[model samples]
Target: MNGHADVGPLTSLDLRLQWRAAATADLADWAALIARTAAVERPVWFERRADLEQILASKKNPAAANTILGFDPEGVARACGRITRNPEGEKAIGFGCVDPGWQGSGIGTGLLGWMEARTRQRFAADADAGADGGSGAAPRLRLHMEQQHTHQAALFGDAGNRIVRYFNEMHRPLQDGFPEAVLDGGLELVTFGPRLHEPVQLAHNEAFRDHWGSEPRNEEGWGFVVNDPLARPDLSAVVVERASGRVADYQLASHDAGSAESRGYAEGYTDLLGVQREFRGRGVAQALLADAMRRFAAAGMDKASLDVDSETPTGALALYAKMGYVAVSTSMVWDKDL
Candidate 1:
């Protein structure tokens, strides 16, 4: 019943399902719908029900206003869509999936139109209120989908959205020993601590400031990362400049039991990795990744994984390759000018 197996034009609208803004009460239904899609396209990446609950609670994507769900007569969610509002950013990012049984029914197309309109409205409201300094740039709608979802390519194409960038999911086995990485003479390595959360966030913003599509995360957006219920501080690593005690690089790691069980292998993930602009060329990233792999191995994980922009300006893809990671899957960004 996965709609992803076949894709069609958005001409037919399935009006049997009732559409409404998401609510906390719909968490179970929405998560089930998400799981169905993940199984068909991205089995290694599934969101646990609790994770969906936490997402519903996020201010930037609150269930009450920013998210929508389509429910059938039996009250089962059949389609879902939402936009992540980064007020300071020039793009509105969307995340959604249609129910497996309803892929070619035009529900996804209808959901996409709603999302595009919703994004335009948000931009207009912000411009009128002079929010985020009103940078005067034309707003864009961006969405991410795995390359394996050929049906999505058709749907997005029909909607006038085109591929913008490619990303790779790289993974290295922990069953084998990790490479030895030494910190630079002026830098020291340390585990992530609660006291360093905000510092790490600041360093992250400064590090990825120039990376494509990376916008500075305000307090709430940053909160979504540091406050993750399964964040592994012991597995996370930070690099500090010895002389000034400045955070030069950081790698945040976490693992979920549900995801591991679904994939049939345990993995420790580098959710975020960043190097301060001043320290990019000092092998800081290599050292941090090596350090992360060792931690994952020690923590009994079977592998270590992270995603990278294929055309990243920093040559991160080569570095990760040198570190023994191999690209296992690809996800792409699609953009439509509004």
Candidate 2:
């Protein structure tokens, strides 16, 4: 039986399902279980549990009002997920995996249902105290999925949600090398700072404006960048408008040396590649990208990688395609109203 309508024999199954707020004690096992599972399943893009712990450490505190839940019984945590409030006042849910032996069981649905209910309860209680005003309605939840993972997609549809958007992961190999070009249109390429934090951040936010699925950057969003395990403050690049002295484009580069795929491979990643709205047709992005490739190549890297919204309004996917990146893998984002 689906966990939503009834808790079945699986509910009373051998493994007990318990819930608790994430704590220091469970951190290690939590990461291990997730890392091992991801390694076996989606090895290429799996995030180590240590990565989650670091994010949690930065977000958790006594004064903060947010929920990060853990589902586990005894020493094993077969599944994990989170519900967070973004700066835009939106509450979101991100969940993944069930112990292989327990796959057919109701644990996955149970955890998600519990999360939805818990979110409503918390938001409702806050509204009662006059913090948000009116009845506390549950916020919507969203998650990412592999485009080919239809079983997981159906699971959400069965629970009364709908697919929202498709997120694509695009890649390119620097091993094939980059194309050289002479500057045209009188535009100049410049590397501002390993020091201009505020400028780069502002330029990034401006560049992303009007793009599909784009959200404003704030302290919370910036937290994701600043605390990212792959975030290398020194390797970031921003393109400046020589005439106006304004940053018209920017890109952030970083690598995952710990990845098993990178054990002996010479590869780096072009993350957060963005070009400003007014600067689109000017070749600013390509210039910055070419410069970034040169930098990574100079650092002795064989390839560079990045992910793009195949449906981005700016036609970024085609831009990357023309620039020599190829589609290596794909993932989609699914969402439902709560």
Candidate 3:
């Protein structure tokens, strides 16, 4: 796979802009460019430079190499995008943001095409290396857009991508006192700790196996999430089945001050919440969520936020609603078979 074309001039753009693969040195500018995109749409959440670093941590493709940036003559970033092909790659996920000024000038379309090609390139590299071609299903390139931004959805539609799924960003005010985690049967709730790291990762893979676009987390990728600087083990909890000492369910939570900057109150987030198939209807999730919410309140957070698949058969949306979480925003997942 030729990686050279990954970065260069953007002659396709209607405006004068240069496209180049990002480097560690460009993270600050890369993040600033995305913030500008969000600022134009809704300044509700912001990602700190560190967050981008954590997201782009990879052995196969370093943060700098896996990301691309579009800059104007002044050396200012006007667009940014990243590509991630998970180990169990049924899908290659593409994330992008364009400067509001450059939105209508073909930057979005150009960036999407670049990522799609990069996805193909990555998969070809894997096949060349004799890696298992992942489920032997047709490869797909996926992109997500906030539902409020119909224009972004239209962009994907114009690119031949189809709506594959929907997701909701839900928030819960830390009012109404937090509830103590209570599990029936032989289940016990405990704070996530060092010893449980790999176990939790393994459990997460099983727990989410049936969910849409879910991919098994390879050790390196799992480490990125488990060891994130913003991760709060104190706020995360796992439900264990005492008899077999198996992880019945888990809630992985984090606090990102940068994300809550626009809000009047501090926010803690449930980054991942999963329940083993056997434990789904037995209250494992409820207990973990309650435990996380309690910890968040104790940590002085004024609200809790989580993103959930709208079409999950696990009834997560209803449960979250039952627990007082309400949809604040929505995002749509679109995919184009590669």
Candidate 4:
């Protein structure tokens, strides 16, 4: 995407604003800014631009704008946020970040204001054209931030939004090894190979649709995932009916050996765990979690961690609790009306 456009002639903080859609060309600088901020603020893992590009590729195109990069009166890109239409056509905005030097200077507030106006205008125009189908647009917006990020919480709250959910970052020490549990008769747990990738991805996409603020993962998402070199297909576990060749439930685990963020030691992570709706309450989640923990332990990793939306309709908190995963940290969601 192009860099922030010039803010010609205006010098006031509010009047000096200019923004432009982020393009692939800006990925290097954008990723660098994000990486630097992440290192100082969270320092959990390595943030590679390539991985982000892959993830972004899996998503659907935005209705109007994909991302907004903000600039000062001097024409410098310093802040950014993303806006996209969810599966239900609800416009969601998230991943807002401002440079540390520019914090508290009203830049973030300006960006939010711009987003609000843009959101309402787009919704109104769509509504007028009968494109809204008379659904009476709600103009939804969502954001996720670390729990301790009080400044961001204040920013969104001041903008007239409330915390809808608090997601917990859970971790278990993997270097200590995972306990193997014997399954009762007729309840066999199996780890499937690449052959089960599509079915498992579909099951997860369906299960996550009911999740809070989640958009359905399209076929392109599965295609990107199947071709991803980072994904360990053999390390994934899929719950089986034993007699039938059907996948009742599944969970995916990934490892970044060199990055401390992936392993929970200021690096490394084991993320992406989901269970099919039909397979809930049958110990499928636990089985898959345990299997992932085992794989992480075998890899000689120090820790395994993942984030879960505590307000999830699936009672995930209780499930994770039962599996011995505890909260290491938390994040809050911020939102506002245009």
Go through the candidates in order and give each one's C-alpha lDDT.
Answer: 0.82, 0.63, 0.79, 0.64
Q: Considering only N, C-alpha and C atoms within 3 Å, which residue pairs clash in candidate 3?
A: none
Candidate 2 clashes between residue pairs 3 or more apart in a chain or in different chains: none
Which ranges of candidate 1 are over 4 A from the true structure?
1-14
- Taking the tens digit of each residue's C-alpha lDDT, what string does model 2 give over 23-114? 56767766776676665555455556556666556542211223233344554666655555442434555565666556657766866675
Q: Write the per-residue lDDT of candidate 3 for residues 1-338, one digit (tens) a residue.
A: 11235443234433567667777778889888877777778744556677787766577555544677777888899887778777457778888888898778787888887777777766776666756454454567888778778789789999999998888899888887765546997999989988999999999999888987888888888888888878999999889999999998988888877656666678889999988888878888888888888889999999888999988888999999988899998888899998
lDDT of 4 by residue, 1-338 (tens): 23334221122124444556666766776676676566556644444676657645644544125566666676665776655443345665655677777788897776666566556655665678766667666776676677666788789888887777778888776655565544445556667577787777777778777777765556775666666556666666777677665667776666665465333353224457776676677777776777777776666656667888877778888877766777888877776655
Using lDDT as the measure, what is the rank order of every candidate, best first? 1, 3, 4, 2
Ten residues in sequence with the least summed lDDT for candidate 4? 4-13
Error of 3 at 196 (Å): 1.0
Off by over 4 Å in 4: 1-18, 43-47, 55-59, 62-64, 71-76, 87-91, 121-136, 182-194, 221-230, 256-270, 312-315
The 10 consecutive residues of candidate 2 with the worst lDDT sum are 1-10
lDDT (10s digit) by residue, model 1, range 83-133: 776776788888788888888988888888867877776777677878758
Cα displacement (Å) at residue 251, model 4 = 1.0
Q: What's the TM for model 2?
A: 0.81
Best by TM-score: 1
What C-alpha RMSD separates each model from the true structure? 4.7, 5.2, 2.8, 4.4
